[model samples]
Target chain A: MKPLLSVRGLSKRFGTRVACRDVDFDLWPGEVLGIVGESGSGKTTLLNCLAGRLTPETGSVTYNSAAYGTVDVHDLSEARRRLLSRTEWGFVNQDAREGLRMGVSAGANIGERLMAVGARHYGDIRRTASDWLDRVEIERGRLDDRPTTYSGGMRQRLQIARNLVSEPRLVFMDEPTGGLDVSVQARILDLLRSLVGSLHLSAVLVTHDLGVARLLTHRLMVMQGGAVVEDGLTDQVLDDPQHAYTQMLVASILPV
Target chain B: MMDTISSSSSGPKEHDGPVLKVAGLTKSFIVHAHGDLALPVLRNVALAVSPGECLALVGPSGAGKSTLLRSLYGNYRADAGSIRVHHDHAWAELVGAEPRTVLDVRRRTMGFVSQFLRVIPRVATVDVVAEPLLRLGADPAEARDRAEFLLALLNIPQHLWQLPPATFSGGEQQRVNIARSLIVDYPILLLDEPTASLDAGNRDRVVELIGQRRDAGSALVGIFHDVGVRELLANRVFEVSP
Candidate 1:
């Protein structure tokens, strides 16, 4: 089958500091790939490049868009790129507040995404928003409340409902569960696990937690100092790590 | 004889005293606008869960399976029944226990995994998972470390440890819920569609974890919609008819 997204010679740098170097990979449909590395590693940079949020210094990121056909993400016109991000792609931010419109009601936030996808009926949009809220475990009665009034977890769930309202084909999540209490993290992970399966979503998840990589991803990529150090199936990489960095990463997890 | 041997080997035998018992458990709801209709959800439901055994609840939708599970967890009050749970080496009636006693039992003896994850906004995922351990008087650092291990096992990425799970996908959120409930070794576990949203691979992982817990002597009561998982985990089956 044709790969859903492909990256070749992908490199990104900030001034003299290299964020990612010579990273190459292919993401198939319905696959969850995890990018694992410590802070300052190029995982986030590579994710940003792949998601078209940051321009790469060299190489190309290509996605097989059902609407636009195979296209270079970076080379697409700004309007078209925005359309793709709004329609075919989703970006889940680490800080939910950053991704959500804090000023608007949660219902409106979710409705906005539906409207962007050409949904015009007010009643239908509201009902959809309400449904999404329930799916994410938020009470339907709180639909009219602003995100500012939502608890940290509620805000994050609202952000997810907003992004997924349009049914994007691929999602880019940067620490989607970051900064939550352990109990809360577990719940979110459970939610994400189910959503990914039912939706058949292809996602590039950037996380430093090896456990997350093991549980959610089919494949894994280990990044260090802005380079792809190792890549393989999730179990193979985790159980019998080939690269020294990957070994250390695996060893660092506290035994359950 | 062969069937008896295999069944006994696979699951706890009935000779062993049950960890949880219910008798004549009935619940009803009043329909406000339907001329004061009393909608009876559960009728004389009786069941027992032995240590190291899993009792699977099988029934169609609207059969009150979830309501039965919640009543077992003390989340709902049974209208007419004695719900007894073994704790502190004695059986205590949960039907009308004091709130403090119920809370104590929940904290130390019973663990529940509900269908929906209740996310407390602004708390980090690690802390959320670690709360049970903290309540059990574990060291803060130890609790956090254990929580990380469980989170990783459930496939929650590390970066999200410090963030709230509210923004996570349905699957990710569900994994978090599993990790939290499974973190502490409660004597009795109540699971409601635990693997409803998990992929095959993750679902297997959860089954493995549950098996481990059962082997460690935890009695389990669960509602498994997935027939395969239900067959794999449940040694005893209880069918609830609507």
Candidate 2:
């Protein structure tokens, strides 16, 4: 089977400081691959490069696009990439406020995706928005409520519904569960797991939290100094971490 | 039934041939921060289990018993050699296999009953147990029915079926874990101390369930801490040393 996303020799640097260096991997369908490291490890840079938000210094980011068969994301025109971002892929940002429109009603936030795919009927759009709200565990009555009125967790859930409402096959998640309290994080993690399974999503998740990585990812790549130090199955990487850097990262995890 | 010892160059070969085989499998962890020192755990291990048979792994702590099990399940990558399982009528090489292939094999042919249940917050116990069937495209109602059947057989009361397993007692959680794995009658099963937390009655029920799987020709490998459980379920015993 062809990989949904293939990244090879991807490197990004800000002047002399390297962010990503010679990173390569293929993300197959229905798999969640996580990139983990401390703050400067360049995990987010790698994700941005994959998402076409950051242009890399060298190498290819090829996506087996559902609409545009096997295209290099960086080579595509700006309009084409934006088209893919909405129709073929979903990007869930770490900050809910950034991902969502605070001024629009929660219903409009979700209906916009369906509308992007040429959803034309008024009743159909509203009905789908209402259904997605329920799927993400938001109150149906809050369809007209702007995101500003929602709590942090509700906004995060609303952001997820908006992204997933379009039924994109691959999702790029940057710390989807981060910055939330432990209890809220657990709820979001649970929702994310179910959504990934039911939708058969292939995701590239970037996070500094190993616990979130363990719960959501099938495979893990550990980075240090902007280079991949280890890559393997999540449990193996966590339970029998092969690299010294991975071991230190695992050890530094505060015991729950 | 107790004569098999397979660490030697030539392992015990089942008459029908082993359903699972491992040869020259080695796994080590390198401490790159500690001047690149390597901590070797599983070293050149070889074993095989046949259909309708249960092989018990007996070893002291830090002897890589659990490591070997996880490696066979493709949780850990072996440095050298192959761990192959006969699945869907062919030997699928697990070591260094693609992640997707490993996942497919796990979904259809092999089952691992970890020590505890990984509760998904608000998911009901029955849905948790019925999940494998759901993934296989079973009807939701039919899947729930089978889940309820297994839950009852494992002595999990009906009322508890609607509740999540997170707050359940240790024994109950383990039973749910076992039921969830057994939902599909996987061709090969890797068990890690599955009955450790159960009381005598529940232990007997679990022993009986595992016995039924073996009787139906599911090759099994496990770590059995209880001597009686070992005697009742193991067709042979394989010993590992650190």
Candidate 3:
């Protein structure tokens, strides 16, 4: 079967700087793909291209999705692209603030997405938001408080719940664990692993942490400069790195 | 009664205690416009920061994280609590400090970065970054020099420094927000979701900058949603529960 998401020779540039070059990949359902790289390695640039945040300089992103089948994401009309962003695709940022409106309460943040996709009944939206907050391990009483009051870990989880509440087919996470503590990072990783597996949702995670990549990704892609230097099963890449950069990265990580 | 703050910017003396202290803090709004007697937003929340420590606060959404941070900086008045800050290097209560003292503490000793970048709609980025310094009585030339240095350190594009941050990307706006915070040599820094709109790389950069600030002897209280960020940046962590 064709993969759910297919990218063919995708490329993006910011004036003289090439953010991504000739990127090609296939993301299947029920799999987490990790993209790891240093700053300016273009890992995030690729994710944005796939998420429809940035238009590609070349090539195409084809989505064989359950709701909208076999269409070029880049070629979709603005309205269709918005529909894709709203209903089928969920993009989680490294910063929870970006993922939510700080002015609104936690319930509203989760419900806004639902409302965007034609969920009008106020009671239903509130109920769904409450359910998601509970699912993400947030207490019920604080649903009316703005996100600014939540801690970093809680905010990130809230962002995750907000995106997942709509049951998006695929979610994009950018450094979801980049700024957390060891204990908190572990819990979040465990939560993400379980959620991704149990829900059978696909994810594209961008991170510089090998531990995070290992915990969540089935396949790992090592990006250098502006291109994918290596791609293989996560265990294979970590256990026996092929590329020099990947080897260096694996060596830098503490052995379990 | 909440502690009272002194009204001057004299150099430090030995009798002063921790820069900020809050105990048994609680706050709520009536929400008269929406409904009468709405629920309280914060309850029995207690936390503190010394002269040079970055305390990271962690909680799920609606846990009163921002309220806790804002109340400390004197933005929101606590309904039933006390916040004592030894401003002016002398012992004093910060709760309901005089306007001059409040302004003094905010201008010279406290720097706040909100989640949204609310730069003057038409102001130049350089001017925005230097505003805090100017308000603190730094010479215009010195303020401009400091702003330029900080912006360069944060890797903000030179040409864009003069352009309104409204035109910048989320990541760029966040950088400017950070620069604005540091423009004044405030002893304490309050950041509410400082990296909320950035990508992996930009988020890391923002974290790095905050780490540097903490190292340079600035006390920090930051509210963040990303666990990775909190772990990397904070030496101490506090979890808030409803």
RMSD of each: 22.0, 5.1, 24.4
Q: Where does model 2 exceed 4 Å of error?
A: B1-16, B31-39
Q: What is the lDDT of candidate 1?
A: 0.83
lDDT of 3 by residue, A1-256 (tens): 6788899999999999999999998887766899998999999999999988899989999998676679998888999888888788888898989988999999999998898778999999999999888888899887999999999999999999888888888999999977888777766786787578557788899999987887778778899999999876675567546567876787788754
Candidate 2, position A23, lDDT? 94
Which order, best to worst by DockQ? 2, 1, 3
Q: Give the TM-score of candidate 3.
A: 0.51
CA error at residue B85 for candidate 2, angstroms = 0.9
Clashes of 1: 69
Can you write out model 1's per-residue Cα lDDT over B192-220, one digit (the tens) per residue? 99998889988988888887778768899
Candidate 1 chain A — worst ten consecutive residues by lDDT sum? A233-242
Q: What digit string (tens of lDDT, one per residue) describes model 2 on residues B68-177?
A: 99999988778998899887777899988877778788888889998888777778999999988788767788778778888888899999999989899999999999
lDDT at residue B6 of model 2 (Cα atoms): 14
Native contacts recovered, each model: 0.00, 0.48, 0.00
Better of 1 and 3 by DockQ: 1
List of chain B TM-scores, one per candidate? 0.92, 0.91, 0.87
* Model 1 lDDT, residue B128, Cα: 80
